[model samples]
Structures are given as structure tokens and as C-alpha cells.
Target chain A: MERGGRFHTKSAELLAQVTWEVAGLPDPEEERKRQAAEFAALAAQYHPHPPLARNLIFAFLVGGSICAIGQLFIALFQSLGMTDVQASARASITLLALGSLLTGLGVYDEIGRVGGAGAAIPITGFANSIVSPAMEYRTEGLVFGFAARLFSIAGPVVTFGILAAMASALIRFLVTG
Target chain B: MVTGNAIAIRQASKRLGHQTMRFETAPAVVASASVVGLREGQGPLGRYFETILEDERYGERCWEQAESRILKEAVNTALGLAGWKEDELDALISGDLLNQISASNFASRNTQMPFLGIFSACATIAEGLLLAATLLEAGVAARVIAAASSHHEAAERQFRYPNEFGAQRPMTAQWTATAAGAIALGLPADGGGGAGWGAAADGSTGEAQLLPRITFATVGKVVEMGQKDPYDMGTAEVPAAWDTLLAHFRETGRDPAYYDLILTGDLARIGSEIFREGMRRRGLDVSSRHMDCGVLLYRPEQDVHAGGSGAGCAASVLASYILKEMRKGRFRRVLFVGTGSLHNPVSIQQGEPIPTIAHAVAIEA
Candidate 1:
């Protein structure tokens, strides 16, 4: 009786296989893909969209304000009889120092949060990117922690910035010649 | 037509089905403790926590050390509440969200108990509870401690950015909670209470019905459906949670209505909504009784984005609010489903999909 039951189940499975082969139904892989796409769409519906317009306005205001502050510093230095180039350089240095000081005081991050890329696209943001990692890794000791990680975030920016500057200089040299 | 040997084997088996385990004697959770940092202390469930630190550092030198210190404090506090000495525990099962589970290992070092560190990401506490209950039921141990913790700054530096690095987090991003929780489980006094068996010193009677018992556990398989977003872990974790919930209900011959509450660990807002919709599509409406630890941890104005997450998110909620409410006879039965995203920074950077898991433990008051 058990052998007969097993034979009956085997026949049923064979019949099902034949029917599946002949039915021209969607293949298992295609079915799986369709299900996955459907589920992904379902999940994506719930994801909250970030407020892009608000963020952009905030970034513009903050970035413009920083640049305005830099201009004020440049004007003050120029009033002291410095050259235009020297005044601008001094303003940049002053902004970097302020950024580093704010980061050390643990206030720049809050500014970054509010300003979005506005605070981040400025010289102050660059200073923050470098100083924060140094402060965070200081616990790993001065050598391996602070000094090594000082350039961890800013290293990419410096490397790429120098490369791009060289490329621009080459382009200018070729065009002028 | 079954043989006597076959009948004995069937009767002796602890497994209900393929994934669920039923203990012959359920282990009682005698005591539990939760410790949280300042941000979580200011959250909605803050008043329920045993220890709330004004400083996230907890007088420690670094965030990692602070996490370990809080975990140790939670374990000690749980043991103190249970009126059990450190020597009374046979093993400590704990894990945390750090490389090599460093926080748990450092915490366990001070515990001086036989340690078994586990990792299933945020599902760690449920995994630990399952193991502890299994150990107690199997007569391997009389008393055991299960704990998990996660620190926001420590995890952020390891997984995303430096604490002071100013980057705008997306709305889908969850704030990793700086919290720790520990639960002490032991065999019922009537069953395996050997030499050190005694009523808890908390003035409760020694009756088993008075304490919440870890009755059943359903182990989950890793489910990956090509979800790759690290910022949106709630969405990544929903499939695994749904898979585990389905398996638990099917294998255990139970339904959504079997438990008074179905608590999901850190599925937050988006994930919970997705989970409910998925369950509804499957003819099971769990919306009425569902609660998420991530959603419960913080208020909308906390700027936690989606919600709070981490191993400690669920652990702290369970050890504090859920269990406390259970003790007060508010909830009679609970299905604690811990959802976890098992992806690291390297894996995420490599564009690999997040493999997630969920472990469900049934607890009854």
C-alpha cells in the first residue's frame, strides 16, 4: 500500500511537470523578478521625500552669508593698506580659523545641520571637515589618531583640487599658446 | 502503526515545527534594567528607564568606553534588582553595534562571568534571550543574563561619519540610540531551583505566574530581496520581519490575535507602515496591535528623522516600558520580534544588498 501511494505521488508530480512545461506560463525567475519589483515599489511609497526647496534656500542664504563675511574681512584688511590679493588671502585664513574654532567649541556641526550644504560648501566647512576627525580620533593617541586622521576627510578634497587645478593650468597654457 | 521508540522521540522533541522551539518549562524573566543617554532620556519613554545619564560620555573617556560602561552598569543593575550576585549567573550573553562587538566584549570583561558574545545586529537581544531561555530549560544553567547596547556617536563614526562631521542626514536615516538593556532569566523555582533557589527580594511572591516567562522562540533565516539602502534600514529590515512573523504564525499554529501585542524592534515609521501593508496584503491585519520600538523611543520634534534604531533601542524598551507594563498586568502576552539589518560599512560601500533577519520570542505575563 505504501509503495502504491508513493507511485501515485510520483505520477502526480510528473503530470504537474508536463502541464507546467506545456502551459507557456511565466518562468520562475521572471515571476521572482516581477514580485521583487512590485515589493520595491510598495516599500518606496513610504519613504519620506526630503524638502529640497527649503534645503536649497537655506544653503543659499548660509553660503552667501559666509561669502559676505569673507568680503567684510577682505575690506577690513584692505583698509589697513594691504593689497587686494593679500587682503583676500587674510580673509580666507580668518574664515578657516573661525571654522576650526567653532568646530572645537562643538558648534559648527549644529550650524552644518541647519545650513545643509550652505555651511558645508564654504571655507569654514572645509576647516570643519578636517578639524572634526582630528578631535574625534584624538582618543586613539596623538600619533595614530589625531595626526593620521587629520587629513582623512579633507585628503580627498585636497588631492582632487590640486589635480583639477593642474589640469586647468595645462588647458590655459595650451589655449594661450 | 507508530513504534514505541518513535512515539518517545516525538514526545521528547522540543521543536514545534521547522523554526519554532517550545520549552518544556518556560524561563522566568526575574528582573531587567535599562540605561540611556541624554537624548533618549529626554524622549517619550525616558521616565521608564532605570538610569538616565546627563552626559552621553557617562564620565568615560570615549564614546566606545562609555557604551561599554553603560552596558556593564545595566547588567549590574539587573542583577541587583533580581537580588542575585554576579556569581549566581552561569553565563552572560550580550552583543552590540561595534566592530568585533568590542563594546560587549569590553563590558563582559568586567562582568567576570562565562561570556558568550553574539551578533545579529539589532536582533541581538532576542537572540540572547532565546539562548538564555534554552540554556535554562535544558538544565544547562540556573540563571543567565542577556543584554545588548549601542552608542550613537560610537556607531556613527564606525558606520557613517565622525561625530563632529557636519553632514545632512536624509529623512530615512535613523538615529542610533545610545542605550543599554539587560534581562535576567532563570528556571522556575518549582522545576530546577536547586541550591540557590529563593524568591526574589523585590517583595513579589515566588509564584511563576507573577513574572513574565519566555515561552517560545522562532528563529529567522536571512532574507535578502535586493534592498541596498543603508540610510533606509527600516525598509531593508521589513522583508525579514514579515518573513519571520509569517513563519512564527504558521509553524506555531498561531495567528496575529494570539498575542496581545506584537512589538517590532526598530522598524520606525516607514518600515512599520510597509510591514503593515504587506501583512494586510497577506490577509493578516496586524495594524491594531502593532507597536515599534523605534517609533516609541522618540517624539516627532526630536529630529531623529525616521526614528530611533540600534540593538539597544528594542532592548531598552523591552527592559523598561514593555516589561514594566507587563508587570502591571497591562499586557498579558507579547510577541517581541527583533528586526536587524546585517550589513557593514564595507559591504554597503561595495553595493551589496542588505541581508536582514528577525527573531521572534513569545513572552507571557
Candidate 2:
């Protein structure tokens, strides 16, 4: 379904009444057709034609760099005598900290703007979601403002993640035990 | 000495002229005031505004309360300038970008006057004017205050995203103007003598009060071109603006050349181009005299991509810059087409397309 279809269906009845009153139209079908054509012409002229290949390359490069940094952090922590699992956890925590700091300093927004969803589909995006609303409502005070709104956007993600984890655990217990 | 035939002919009303309404007794804008925040005060038309706030909060606890304060200041200033008290006002028509129009509603609480809260998104000023003019022409209201306001932070949290999110905005995104504007509308005080608040009522300057009068109004139809991206609002609004302009011309039988200035509510830079190009193709080229309040509000160097927007954008510009220019005899006639994209964050998230509207009011000096 086209994006315009959503608008046309929702507004058709009311818009028909308006056009009839304003244009003094004799036929509703003809006016609707004319409007549809006009919208088509406008869409043809202004609709963005994204460069898929270029976008894919940027996404790969940015996404790979983020992962590479995480691996380096894990390796460095492991060399310091930590277990593999412990190192991985520490690396993820470090990345989350950096993402939150960048978001607070107003640098992450610029990167997300230029990189599009390339910057948003990563763990850094998760950190941003948690930090963003907290800072926005700081004026509302700590308890009702920052704390209450801290997980407004990321709360659903955390809820679903825990739910899925519990289900996986229950299945494993039933099959193996 | 006047003949009965002449009296009957004069009294015969032309109820419908195309899609427009021609007023027999046009309501005049006697006084107006504009109050803006720091960023807006730094814009190109900053000097013309009545008050420039150094702080967005205006000493309020929250951004919403700050917006309400801006509205109250604008209304009070306008009333004071017109030498009228709140008790004298027949009704107050106001709106804002906040949900339930809480900004205007809360601000009007102290006025103790009859309140009419309206919402047309960014086209609120024109809608307020249209309703106020209707009341004045019908003799239901001798004096009315029309106002609209918008606050960047309050609007951001409500309609878009959290301001602290540092979300990267697209180049198509427009900055909401943190401003409020109000205008006093009334007829000549007496039987054609033009005494109270007329052109000569500006006693401070010892010059005639040369106020602008709203002569005609064309209520716009909601038009949706199916552009759903909220950041690129100009695209969604252009078609509605064109529709209203076309309707106004068709109804009035006047071409683009009829007015010295033709202004759109807040099409900004990108939408203004689309509007001009679209009109050119239809053989109604208004590029020469066409200007947008969004484009004029902020300077290009300000980095307000696509320029300023919001209900207050056009309202502040009209009350401050445009009205002052008209009083100076710079423009004899003007047409203000206020365009609005009627969509909220919930609707956009649900994959709904934006519906748009534009209301036009013809003001003459």
C-alpha cells in the first residue's frame, strides 16, 4: 500500500465535503481524480530516491567499526586476566558508558543525523534511548522527572527482552531436566 | 435625498462570492503586540517585536508554564497599547501548540474574559482572526482579542521528541518559534466618525492610527498530499496553501497582482519553493510579491534549517513587522495564508499521512 493511500482513505469523506463546498464542484469523482493526479505529480518530483548501494556501504563500514571497537575492548580486558564472559560483559558496559556520555554532550545526535539508521541500530542507540528522556525532564526534579521518564522509550525493550529470556530458560529446563 | 431603490441595492448582501466572504463592515486591527524568546529575538525581525525575553523560562517552573506566560504578556501588552482593559473585551480567541491548547487556556485564566480556545496547529492565528471577524461582522462582539503562541521545548516534548535526546534533525526540519502574538480587533467607535482606535488613535506619535483592516477571508479546505515525514512538513503543507490561494483568487476575481504582499503562514524555505513552482505551472506566478513568514523570521546564518515555523511564527511577524510596514505606507494590501500540518506523534507513529490546511485573510491599510 502507498503512503498516500493512508491519507486518501482517512480524509476522503471530510475532504469531499470541503471540496464540494469550496470548489462548488458538480462531480465528486472528477475532483478526487484531479487531486490524486496532482499528488502523484508532486510525489514524482519530490520523493527521495535513496542511493541503496552507497547507504549499504556506509552502514557496513560504521557498523563494522563499532563491532571492531567492542572486540578490542574485550581482548584488552581478557589480557588483564579476566574470564571470557567477564571481559565481554565489561566491554559492553564500557561501550554503553561511552554512548551515554556522547549523547549527554550532544555529539551522538549529530552522528545519528548524518549516519541515519546506521548509528541507530546499534547498542549505542540503546544507551541513547535511556539517557535522552532522563536529561529532557531534569527540570521536573529527580524522582518525578528524571527517574520516572528514564526508561520511557527503552522500557518496552527491557520488558520484552526479560520475557523472552525467561521463556528460553523454561524450555531448556523442561527438555534437559 | 437618497432614493429607496439605492438604499435597497446597498443593503443587498453578497453572501457567497466564490469560496470567499466579502465583508460589508470590515473589522480593523487597532493594536498588536509580539513577545519572543532569546533565539527569536536574535532573528531578522527581532527589532520590531514588542518584548524580547532573555530567558525561555520567563522565571516559570516548567516550559509549559513559560509558554503560558508568553501568551499572557502578549495579550496584556496588546490591550494596553489599545488603551483598553480586559473588562472591555467581548471575547478572547487564542490557541497554541500544546495539547488541549493548555498554554492559551491557562494564560487566559487571569483575564476574566470569555474564552474561545481553538486549534489549527500552525495556522491558528488565521483561524482565530477568521472567528473574531465573524463575530465582529455579526455585531456579536464589538472588541475581540485574537492570539496564538508556540514554545520550542514544550512543543518538542509533546509533538516530536525529547529536547535532551540530542536527536539528529534532518535538513528539512524547522525550528519552532518561541513566541506569542496578539491583536485587538474592533470597528470604528461611532457612526462613521472614526474616533476611538482609528488611524489617528496613535496619539503618542501624533500620527493617524493607520490600522490595517481585514476586508475578506476564505476558509480553507483540509488537503493531504500524503507526505508523512514530520521533519519535511513544508512538503505536506504546500498543497494546502496552494489550494487556499487558488480558492481566494477564484472567489475574489483578483489575480496575484492585486496585493502588494502575499505571505504564507510558515512554509519556510523548502515549502515556499514548492508553492511557487506549483503555482507557476498552474499559470498563477506569485513569486515576485510572495514572501513567507518562516523565511523572514530567522536569518540563514542562524542554521535554523528551512527557517522558523509554528503558530507564533506568522503571528509574531504579522503583528510586529508586517503591520508596522503597512502603517508606514510600505504596503497598501496584503494576503496572509496560514498553512498548517495537522499531525501528532501518535498519528505519525501509526503510519498515518499528514493532513494540511491553509486559511487566507486579506488585510488592507
Task: Judging by lDDT against the true structure, name the best candidate.
Answer: 1
- Give residue B172's error in model 1 in angstroms: 0.7
How many angstroms is residue A20 displaced in model 2 relative to the true structure, after the best TM-score fit? 16
lDDT of 2 by residue, B309-351 (tens): 8889888998888877776678889999999989988899999
Residue B188 miss distance in model 2 (angstroms): 3.8
**Interface RMSD, Å, model 1:** 1.2
- Enumerate the candidates' DockQ scores in order: 0.57, 0.32
C-alpha lDDT (0 to 100) for residue A20 of candidate 2:
82
- The lDDT for every candidate, in the order shown, is 0.89, 0.83
**Candidate 1's residue-wise lDDT over A76-177, tens digit each?**
999999999999999999999999999999998988888999999999999999999999999999999999999988999999999999999999999996
Could you give the C-alpha RMSD of every candidate to the true structure, in order shown?
6.7, 7.2
Off by over 4 Å in 1: A1-32, B1-13, B190-209
Number of the top candidate by DockQ?
1
For model 2, residues A2-99, the per-residue Cα lDDT tens digits are 77897788798777778787887656666666776776576447544555676667667766777798899999999999999999999999989988
TM-score of each: 0.90, 0.81
